[model samples]
Target: MADYPILAVVGHPNKGKSSVVSALTQNDQVHISPLSGTTRVAQHFSLKLDGETVFELVDTPGFQRAAKCLAWLRVEELPADQRPARVAEFVEQFRSSGQFFDEVELLKPIVAGAGIIYVVDGSLPYSPEYETEMEILRWTGRPRLALINPIGGDAYVAQWQQALNQYFSLVKQFDPLHASFDQHLQLLRSFGELDSRPGRIFDQAIEQLEQYRRQKLEQAARILVENLYRLLTYQQSSSRLEQAAREQLPELLPAEISRFNQHLNWLERDGQQQLEALFLYHRLESDLARLEVRQSELMDESQWTLWGLEKKQLVLVSAAAGATLGLLADAGLGGSSLFAGAIGGGVLGGVSGWLGLDWFKQQLPAWLQFSAEQHLLGPVKDPNFAFVILGRALSHARAMLARSHADRERLTIHQAGDHFMQSLEMKVQIRLLKQCKQLVRQGPQGQAAEQLRAWIYQQLTA
Candidate 1:
């Protein structure tokens, strides 16, 4: 039972309570409104790891009848110990009463044994009026903490912190919209410090949350591996036709390339959805348009600056891949053979085809044999283009990692000081690039697939 702690997030209307829950749970589905009293009832969101619940967060409607509720509780007709019963009596009388409905909804969970996590807008000046609400919560005699969430700026944080301390046993400041990964954990750890609740399970909650974080990173790595494989190896073909129809091939071919490129773009969008869902930000649409990593086109120059490798790095890896193919070609021809001239041309062609290949150049596959009936394109070419695919994937993953789950602002990724691929070791980069090339050639087997997954995992998370 200690493994599950129920926390009720309560506050005044429009004070960013939903934002706090969203950030803590990494869930974007919670509705947040600027208008007063958006959440009219209590909503429960649970944090689960491996299909089991770790902790639950209850987002309750904000206080509406604090003054009246406090006024009723202070009648003094009831003894000190009986005040809790008075509070309960008030709920029984007004649970469905129109004016006190919001207050009742917010207080129901606290009366039921959930710990209180009171939220306040630190951006607003601290006032005496909210004391009525705090006094009402205190009358319930539940374990409680105060959260000073700065919705706009921190000009009043010091004041909010000072005033909140007198009422709540613990007072902490959190900016739900901008809090970092560490701040989320620290806030949860602070909840474990409440004195009223014995056998606190926050330590267990923290452990599960951390494990969930690493598992999410692993999911992102798998996405890069499998999606990159399909995209790099995607192939399409059209049989060449003779006669008057042959002239129309020009129009049909470019359209085919466009269609294939569109498919790759579809893969990217699908991947974005997967990563967002993994972290529980399922409702928010990606704000990729104005960011540095935005891809206006598959190989847009702007994206290249953000996710592409340096030209020199691409050249070195490409040269190594070419050399490897050359050795294979030479080995295929036996050692003691002067009759090798017959196949010598084939060897030079193979080596030069790899060395001089632009990978990015818009050309139909040279492998397309002009047999009486065929023309084919794709199985995306090597290193440079593979880097292009990888660069975009990495940029998207990093953006999702850095964003606060509660942030609704248009998704934007500022350029990392350097390219994402630039951080990997040279050999890792080469091996990864070669793997992309191999996928294009024969597809990944069990061993190769695991190697691909490991390399992608390192680049994404290491």
Candidate 2:
């Protein structure tokens, strides 16, 4: 226990103490409330890697009787070396006293070898009243760091920082709700500086944490890609049923289409949930104001306009894919060059544009197919369906990653710019679009999807 570094976050009532713990641990499940004194006792959070504790953080109750506790300790002129024991004695004596319950709970961790992480609400004015808590922590003689956390808009932080530096060995400003991953990591590394004994352990733990974050991002991308493969190739057909059921195809067909759409929705929702978990978030809220209008809305009018490539980008993608097909056709026709193949693709594309997308969708096999008595709705074979699914996935991933663990803030995507697809290089755009098209039409292309997965991983890290 002595070797394991424990950080006990001690502070005044409602000063974002639990928020700091949540940010550092990346655990949204930590209870947080606006009211003061929400945490009645010290709750230990052992930061772990594969079930092995790397370090510990204790979210302790705010001090309710710091001045009283400090005065009682001063009643005895004990030697400097004996102050820690005196503080522990005060907790022992007051355990049965309800007046100092909060003080006793907060001090238990420090008495048991946890280093102090004193939190102060820097948004408010600095005052001498806080020194009672600071002095108690100093008297314990354990390594200490003071955090000036802004809980509101008006940040009079300079005075808070100056005051904290007087008592604690290290002082820092951290916004528990909005700090970036880098800031969280840097704070953890700073904890290593508090004491020489815990320095190496903190270093090793931070190293593991960095690797873990990267792996989680990759894992999320893998999930998205796998789901996209399924959605693109998804098919729902109705056959081998009673003649009465088959004769009711007029009414039954629309139901099948509705069910297929529902399936896609479920797939997207599942992917979003999986992404949230990979990012270590159990709670997510939508941001209506910041998200692209199309993205924020439901799929009624197909809100993929800002998430997917525009019509021109699609034309280029189609041309590229069609060129590949035409080149093979040309080779079969005994042509030595791809020039004829390129012309063939151009004519094919022009014909498609003239035919309209909906007509092409209807013409594709396995979609609205009919026999003497048998009929089918779809595992939509339209390549555009793949693009639509991919767009939704990308939109969901971007929104989730941007604000997945954000405290008290809703998720949003700024839609002032071009679609995410437009930001990619032409080759990647074409490759992704073509891959989706191929997967939907031919079904489950391992090699193409693997390449797309690698691309997605790169995009996420970048």
**TM-score winner among the candidates?**
1
lDDT of 1 by residue, 1-462 (tens): 335888899988888889888888888888887787779899988878999877888999988778888888887766668777788888788887765888888877777778889999888899999899988888887778898887888789999888888888899888888888888889888888874455658888889888888787777777776777777766556653233165565555445555555666777777777777777766545454334234634543334345645555555655555465452233232221212221234432322232222212244223232345555455544445676777777777777777877787777655567576766677767676666766666555545666777766675554
What TM-score would each prediction reach against the true structure?
A: 0.83, 0.83
TM-score of candidate 2 versus the correct structure, residues matched by position: 0.83
lDDT per residue for candidate 2 within 1-462, as digits (tens), equals 655578999989889888888777777777788888789988888656666776778999998888888999999788889999998898789887776889888888888888888888888999999988899998998889888887785468998888888898799998887787788789888888787672477788788778777778778778977888776655555563225453554455445555656666666666777787677666663443233333432233334344554555555554565565452232222221222222234333222222122223334322555556555544444344466566666666765655524375666545436466666677766667677655445544466767777777776666
- CA RMSD, predictions in order: 6.8, 6.3
The list of candidate 1 runs beyond 4 A from truth reads 1-3, 77-81, 195-200, 239-248, 286-296, 300-303, 324-374, 438-445, 455-462
Best by lDDT: 1
Candidate 2 Cα RMSD (Å): 6.3
> How does candidate 1 score on lDDT?
0.69
Q: Please report, in order, the local distance difference test score of every candidate based on alpha carbons.
A: 0.69, 0.67
